[model samples]
Target chain A: MKILEDEKIVGLFFERNEKALRETEASCGALLRKTAKAILESDSDVEECLNDTLLSLWQNIPPAVPKSLRAYACKVIRNLAFKRLEYGLALKRSINSELPLDELEAVLFDLKTENEFSDVEFTLTLDSFLGSLSAESRAVFLKRYFFCDTVPQIAQDLCISESKVNSLLYRARKKLRSVYEKGAEL
Target chain B: MKKYRLSKALGEIDEVYIEEVLKYTEDAAAGKRRGIFGRKRIVTLALAAVFIAAGTTVTFAAACGGLQSISEHFTAYRTDIKGVGDTSSLPVIENAWSIGKTMDGEQDALAGSIKVTSAVCDRYSLYATIEFNAEGIDIPENIPDEELTFDIINAKSGIEGACRPVFVSREGDIFTYIIHFSESSSINGDEIFIEAHNFGRSCTVEIENIGRRLVFNSVEYCRIKFSIPVSDLLILDSVQSLNSEKIDGIIDMDAELSPFGFVVRYDESQVPAWEEAHSELLKQYGWEWFKYSTGTVYSLLSFKMKDGSTLENVHNLIATAESGSDPNSGKDTIHFSFIVPVDISQIESVTYLGAEFRFDAEAYD
Candidate 1:
C-alpha cells in the first residue's frame, strides 16, 4: 500500500482509527525494527519491543502529535529495547556488554560530581552542546550514541573510513567532556 | 551521572536534533546536494565522452568532473575536519575517468533497467553513481527507501565489498543513488559490476478502469557492468619517517601524506613505561584515563609547511587503528589518519611528540 504521510497517520490516531497502526507499521516498521535490533539481541525481544512501541504510540498519540512519526516511533522503540536489554542483563542473560554506553560514560566523566541537575536541565545542556557542533559532527554523534550504530556501519553509510568515524567520535566525546567540565565550573 | 541516566537524558533531547540526523542520513543516502543546509554546489569542468558499444551508447566522462563534486560533497559532509573540503583546494583525483553503462538483458525481464551514471576514483577511494529506472513498473508513491538495496563487485576477482547506496533523487520513474568503495584492494580493478535488488514492497495498485485496489509485492533484480581503468589513476606515493623523542616509549614513526590526507603509524613498544609516564593521571581518571592520554598525544602533533605556515594541533585526525590490544604485551602498532587534505609536496616537517621529523633533501630519497 502507498505509505501515508505522517500527518495523515497522526490524524488517524487522533480519530482512533485502528488503521493508524497498520499505516505506522508500513511506513516505519523497518526503522522501528532496525532501532530495536541495534540494542536488543534476540529477534523475539525486538518483536516485543516493536509491539510495545505501537501500543505506546496508540495510547499516546492523541496527547502527542509528533512532527515526524518515524522519529517518534524510533525513540519509543529504542527506550523499550534498552529496558529489555537492562532487564536481560539483570537476569544474568548472555547479552553482549559491548554497547557504546561505556564510551559515553567516559565522555561524560565529569558528570560523576555530586551536583544534581534535573533531567530537563541535563537534556537542555546536551541540546545546547549538540547545537554548537557542526552539522557533520552532530549527525555522527547522534548516529553513534543516539542511534547505536556501529563505527563500521557509520563509516560505510557516510562513505568515509572506519578510522574517520572513530576520530569523529573521539573529537565529539572530547568536546562533550569539556562541556561537562565547563558546566561543573558553573 | 550514571551511564543509564545520561542515556535517558540523551533520549529526552529535543526531537529536532534527532530529525536533523535522520534527514542527514536520508540526504547522504540519496546523494543529495550537501553543505551548510545543502545550498553549496562547488562547480568544476566535467568532460563527458559518449560512444556506442553493442548497439548501446556508452559514455566515458572525465573522472575530474565527478572528483570535485564527490570531494566537495564529502567536504561539506565532513566540515568538522579542519582544512578539508575547501572547494578552492586542488582536486584530489589527479587523473580521473567516469564510465556509464546500461544493463543489457535485465531490462527485458523487469521492463526496466539500471544504469551506472558515473564512477570515479582517487588514490584511496572509488565513488560512483547508479540510476535505477522503473518506467513500466508501477510503484506506489512514498514507498520505504529500504525496500531497495545495491551492491558492488570487482568483476576481475569476483570479490564483493560492502557497498551502501545513498539515494540521490527520483524523477518520473528513475531513482538515482551514489556508492563509495574505499578498500584499496577491491577498487584497483578495471571493471566492476553493480547489482540492484528490489526486495519487494506492498503497494496498492488500482485496476485500470474498475477503481479496485489490489496490494502486491514488486520484487526485481538486475546487474549492470562498467569498465574504467582505475589503475591508471594517479598515485601519490609519499611516505616519510617521523622523528620523535624517546620520552613516552612510543617509537618508529612514519607518515604517508597525500592530497586527500595523511596517515601516521608508530609502534608503542614500551607499554609499561608509557603507562608509568601517565600513571598519576591514570589513577585520577580511572576509566577515562585512556581517553585523556590519547587526546594529549593527538594534541602534540603538528605539520610544518614549506610556505613557513604551521598546521598546529591537527586535532581533526579522522581515523586511528591499533593492532595489539593487550597493554601488557608491550607491542602495539598504532595508526592515525588525519582527514585534513594537504599538499604533501609542500610539507616541510612534522612535529610529533615534541620532536621534529623534517622532510629534508636526503629523506626524499
Candidate 2:
C-alpha cells in the first residue's frame, strides 16, 4: 500500500474522509503504538487508548490543524495512554507502579515554591537557557524530560555511552537550575 | 506544582517547536540528521520544550484507614421516583457494606452551609448527596454543567486523585455528586479522603435584600475536605459464569455478572478457523443497536432482573488483544465490560437485538 504524505493525509481529513484515519494509522501507527506501549502495561488498554486517540483526533481535527501530524498524534496518544495508566493504577492493576516522570522532580521548580514563580515567566527563562545550549545538548535534555525517555534509552538511541548520557543530563539539569535560580532571584 | 500542573504547562508549548523536536527525534532514530532544524526553529523548539516534566502526583485529601460502623438506614436503592422516574427501575446504589453515613460539613467562604446527606460507593464510583443552604443567596441547583472540581484519594493505595463525576444532578435544595474512579480503585477499602471545590456564581441568585435583583459579584467558591468510611464493596468474584454457545466456530461468548456490573468477552481466535467470520460480523454489524470500529464492536447488553427491573449496560472499559501472523491479518479479541446497578444472580436471560443468550443453570456448576 502506498502511504500518503502528511499533507495529503491532512487534506483527506479536511475533506472529512474516514480514510483519513486509516491513512494516519498507516503512517503514524508505529510511532503512536510505541509511545503508548512505553507507558501503559496492558495490551488491551494500549489498543483501546490508541483507538480512542484516533477517534478523538477525528472528532477534533475540524477545529485543530497541526503542521506535524506525527507529533500531534504522539502527544494525543501519550496523554490517552497516561490516563489509561492512571486508571489502571487507581484500580491497583498496573504492572509497573513507577511512572516514567519520577526523575523530573529533581529538575522541576520545587512544588513548595512553585507558586512563587510564574509559569509564563519561568517558561520564557527556561527557553532562553535552552536556546543557549548546543543542538546535541538540547536534544538530550528534551529526550529525557519532554519525551520521558530513560537515560539508558537515550544513550542507546543517541549511540553514546550511558555515562555520556548521564553527564549530558547532569549538565542540563545544572544549567536549568541555575537559570531558574537567577529567574527566581529576579 | 502537581504533575497535572506540569502537563498543563507543557501543553502551552508552541506547536511548531513540538513538531520540530518530534521530527528531530525521528531523524536521529533513523540515523538521518543531515538537515538539522535551523537556528530560528531551534530557538522556538527550546522555548516550547522548557516546561518541566513531572510525573502526575495523585493527591488525596483523606488521611488513613479506620473502619467505623455505619448505623444509618438509608435505602441503598434510589427512591425519588419523581427525579429519576423515567427509568424502568429504581437505580440500585451499589455501595456494598455501606453504613449509609450521612456526612455534614460547612465552609465559611461558600457563604452557606453544606451537608452531605447521603454517601455511597461501589468498586467503580462514589455517590454523594449534598445540600447547600445560603442565608440571603438564592443558589441555583446544578449551576456548573461539566463537574465540580474535586479529588477523592484512597490513602491505602497510591492511585492519583479522582476524575470528574459520571453523573451530577440538582433538584430543589439538594445537589448530587456521583464521582467515578477506576474499578481498580481502593474505594472498596475502609477509608477514603475527599477534597472538593465548589465553583459557581450567584448570577441566578436573587438578592432577597436587594428586592429580587441579580447579584453580579456573587461568585461562590468553597474548598471542602471530608472522608467516608465504606464497609464492603462488590467485586467480581464468585460470579455465576454461563456457558455461551460458540458462534461460527470462530467467535465465543463468555458472560458473567454480579451486583455491580457485567462482563462480556467475544474471542475470535480461540478456535482459529479465522476466515474473517468474526471480523465480518464486527464490520457488517454496521450502526444497528451495536457500533463497530475495525476490530471491536460496541453494543448495549440488556437483561431483565428477577425483580422485573431492567439493567442496561453502560460501557466503562474495553480490553482488546490482537493476534495474527501478519500485521494486517490479525483478529482482535475483545472484552467489553458494562457497569450496571443490578444483581447478577437475579438475571434470567441476556437479550441483545431480539436474540436471547439463556443461562444454563446446570452448566454453571
Candidate 3:
C-alpha cells in the first residue's frame, strides 16, 4: 500500500479528518508496535498503548505541529509503553536478564539524589554525546535504549552477531556513563 | 537520575537521531541491507556451502573441504562469523555456483606457503578462503584472538580494497582464514592481488612453553601475497525502459543479476523535475532534508517472482549518485542490490518506480 506522506497525514490531523488516524497508523503502526512490544509484554497492553498513541497524535497535532510525524508518533508510543510498564498496567514479560531499563542504571548511578540538571539539559548532553559516536554505534545505541530492541533482534537486523551487539551496547553504555558523570559534576 | 527519566530524555534528543534510528529499523524490518559494505557473514558462509555442494573441487590441502573442515578447529575471533558450523543446513544457500580456482601465494618467512583455496564472487564483492601454513616453525600453543588484516589490490589498476577476515581457524601448524573483499565501487578485474599483512603485529602467537609472545616485528615476517583470477564469476544483465506517473521522469534501468544479489542501475537524470524538487528540499532543510523526503527512489524498485511472491525491501547495497559538469543536469546513477540472492529465472517481472517490466524466461537460460 502506498502510504500517505507525513505532511499530508499531519494536515489531515489538523483538519480534524478521521482518515488522519488511519493514515498515521498505516505509515507508523508497525514501528510503533515494534517499539511498544519491546517494552510492554502483553499483547492486549500493546494494543491499548498503540490506541493511546494514535489518540495522542490526534489530540496533539493541531496545536503542536511536529517536525516529523513518524518521530512524534514513535515518541508518544514509547512514552505510553514505558508508562504502562511503570504503572503496573501490564505484566512485564522477561526480555532477557538485562532489561534495557536496568542497563541504564550504571550510566546514571553517579547522579543519585543530588543531581539537579533539568531533563532538557541532560537531553542536550546526550545529544552531544550521541554526536560524538560513530554512525553505526549511534544507531545501535538508539535502537537498544530508545526502541528497546532485543540483542538478537538487533543482531539479525544489522547482520551481525549477538556478541557484537552486546559489545557495542557495552561500549556505548560505558561512554554514556562517563558523559553522565561529567554532567553530574557540573 | 532515573532510568525512565533517561529514556524520556533520549526520546527528546534531536529528531535527526531518532529519524536515523527509525530509518535503520525500517530498512531492517523490510530486510534491507544494513551496512555500507553489506557483507553478511552468514551470506558468505552460505556461499561457501553452495560452492562446495556444487562439486567445485578446490585443490587446497587445508580448506578443500570448505566450511565444514574449518569449523572443526574454528576459534571465535573479535568478529565472529555467525553459523559457521551449520552453513550447509541453511535454506538460503541455494542457486549459487562454485569457483574452485587455486592460486599460488608468494612464499614468506613467516610460513611455508599461502594459497587461495575456495573462492566466490558477486559483481560487488569477493569471498575467498586462504590457508596459511606455518610448517617447521617453533609455534606457540596459544594464539591471540586478534584478526589478520589484508587488502585486495587490483592487479591492473593497483587500486586497493580493504579485506575483512570473516572466520579464522587453526589446525596444528596451519591457519585457515575466510575473508571478504568488498568495495564501494564494483570489484571488477580479471585478476587481483591479495596482500595479507599484520600477521605478527596484529596477531601475536604466545609461546606458552617459553612463557613469551613471538611477535614478528619485521614486515616480511607478516606479509604474504596471492594472485587469483576472477573472470569466471557470472553476472547477468538486462535493460528495460520504464515510465511511471509516480516519478517525474522515464527510467532506463539496467539490472545485473550476480550470484550474491541483484544490482538495479538507473539514471535519475531523466527525471529533471524530481531532481529539482530534491534540490529545493535540500536547500530548504539542509542536512535535515532526508527526513522530509517522502520516499527513496530505490523503494520503488522490487521484484515479482515466478513463485507468486513479490520480493519487497530489495536492500540497496550501495547508492552512489554521480553528477555531470552541470550539477542541475541531474545526471545520476543509482545501484540497488537485493539483500538475498534470487534465482534469475524466478524473477518474472521487475517493478521499477510505478512501471512494470516483464522478463522472458529464456533470457536467463
Candidate 4:
C-alpha cells in the first residue's frame, strides 16, 4: 500500500496486479472501513464506499503517484463517502448538509455544486472549494479537518496571526450553519 | 456517529481520500531530487499498451537539451544523402549495364543491381530496430526509435531477368536507420531509404549520432543494419540524393506474410482449427474475433466454386482469418502459408492481413 517502497510491488499495482490489489485492500482495510463508518453511519454503505474507493485508487494511481499513501486513502474515501451522502439525500433540493451533520458541513457549504467539477468527479469538487476559500479560511479548515492541524500549528503553518486562524474558523462555522439551515438547493 | 469517531473522521479526510485522487507528488519529487539526473525514469505506459519504455538511459544533459531536436526530426521524412562518394551518375550502374524500367513500371537489371529505396540526413545520435512479421510493429512514441530495410539486387545490365544487389558486403546486406519522437506522432509525408549496397553479405548503413559519438549498439529485431554504415559526420551531411522522391508508398505483395506460414507449414497437428477462417488466429493477432468449442471460429474460405477453374484460380489468393483465441492479449502469431503472388511487382503497397491492424512493427526495408 505504501507508494514508494520497492518499485517491484509498486510495479505490481502499476501492472494492475490482482494479488497486490487484493493485498492493498487487506492492508488498508481497517482504516478505510473505519473512516467510512464514521461518515456514513451504515456498515453496508461503508463497505460499498471502501470497495469503490479502492477500485478508483487502483485505476487512478498509475498516473497519479501519491506522496503519502495514507493521505491518498483518506482523500479518496472521504470524497466518495461525501458524494454518496449527497445522492442518498431525501431530495436533490436538500443540497446543503444539516449543521447537525457536523463533520462535512463546514467544507460542504463552501463547496460549489457537484456539476462544476465534472471531469474531476473524484476529488475535484472538494479541491475547488478549498481553493476558493481565503488562504486563512482554508488553513483553519484543514487544521480542524484535513490534518487535525492544531491552533499553534495552523498559526505556524500559515505564518499568520493566531487570532486570524481563530477568527477564520468562527466565520467558516457561522456561514456553514446558515447555509445548512437554508438548505441550498443544488 | 460517536463523538470520538466524528473527530477522527474530520481529522483524517485527506488521508481517507488519497486513493481516488491523481496525485502527481511522486513525479514532482523526482524533478526536485537532482535536476534531471535525480529524476526517476518513470516509463509511463500511458496510451500505447505494449510499448516497453525502460525510461531509456538517456544521458542527462543530452536528454534535456536534445529532447526538442530529437522529436522534430524524428517526426519528419528522411531522404538519401551522401557527402563523399566514389560513385557515378552515368548510363551504367554496375560498370557494364544500365537498369531499365518497363512500360508498366517494372524494373529490370541484367543480373546484379542495387537500388536505394530512400534515405535521409540524420544529425542526432539515435538507434533504431525495425522488424516485419505478421504482428506489425510497436514503436515507442516518446523514445528514440528506428528501423532499417534492404533488398538484394544484381549489378549486370545485359542479363534480362531477376536482378539483385551486386557484392552486398556481408555487413552491407543489412541497412541501418534511426528515429526519435516524443509525445505526439505524425503520419504525413514521411519517407526512409533502404539502401541495397554491395558492402558485403551484410549491410553497413549509417544512422544518427549526437554529441559527437556514434550510436551503434542499440538495435533490436532486424539485420538490415549490416549493409549500412554510420558516417563520421558530427555536422549534418546531406546523403547523396537519388531520383526516388519518397519511400512512403505502400508495398503490395502476394508473398504470404511470414506468420501465415507458421501455422500452414505445420498444419498436421491442428487441421480442425485451420478449417474456418481460424477465429483463434484472428483473436491472437489483436483482432475482434470469437471461437466456439467447435467449427465456428474461422469464417473465411479460399473462395471455392462448383467449377474447377475457380478453385485453381483461388489456390494462391489471400484472405485473412477472422477468429482467434484471445483477442486482447495481442500475443498472436498465427501460422499460415500461401504462394507469393506472381504479379507482386505490379503492386506497390505492402500488403498485410485483411483487417485494421497496428503492430510493434515499423516500415519495411
Best by lDDT: 1
In order of listing, the candidates' clash counts read 10, 6, 0, 112
Taking the tens digit of each residue's C-alpha lDDT, what string does model 1 give over B1-365? 55476676677777778888888787555432222111111112222221233333444442333444445445554555555223233222322223444333234344567656655433344455666667776655567654444433333321134454665455567666666544322123344444444424445677888886745354554444444443323233344454434434444445444444343444332433455677786667652323543464456567676767776665454343222111112122233433333445566776655666776422211
| Clashing pairs for predicted structure model 2, backbone only | A91-B184, A91-B185, B58-B160, B62-B193, B70-B99, B96-B232
Cα distance off (Å), candidate 1, residue A183? 1.3
Candidate 2, residues A10-79, lDDT tens digits: the string is 8888899999999999998887787777777677777897899899889988788877887788778877
Docking class of 4: incorrect
Model 3 stretches astray by more than 4 angstroms? A89-98, A111-114, B1-3, B28-365
The candidate with the higher DockQ, 2 or 3, is 3
- Please give the ranking of all candidate structures by lDDT, highest first, separated by commas: 1, 3, 2, 4
**Tens-digit lDDT track of model 3 for A54-161:** 999888988998888888888889888877777763455444344587776656765663257777787888899999885656888888888888888886665555
Tens-place lDDT digits, model 2, residues B1-365 = 55544433443455455566666566455432332211111111122123112221111111001011111111322332222322335333243322233455535444555554444333333444444444444545555632332222222221124543332444444444444333321233344555555544324455556667644332355565555554312132324355564544445555444344443444332422333445565346432111332122334345655666654542221221211111011222222322333434456666543334655322111
TM-score each candidate.
Answer: 0.44, 0.37, 0.41, 0.24
Query: True-contact fraction for model 4?
Result: 0.10
Chain A agreement with the truth for model 1, given as TM-score:
0.94
Chain A only, candidate 3, TM-score: 0.88
Compose the digit string of candidate 4's lDDT tens values, residues A1-186. Answer: 443343444467778876655665666667677556645766888889988987887888788766565567666786687666666664543332322345444344444442232333324334444445544355456545543335565554444445545655655654444443343343
- Model 1 docking category: incorrect
Model 4 TM-score (2 dp): 0.24
Ten-residue stretch with the least lDDT total in model 3 chain B = B322-331
Deviation (Å) of A69 in candidate 2: 0.7
- In model 4, state the lDDT of residue A116: 38
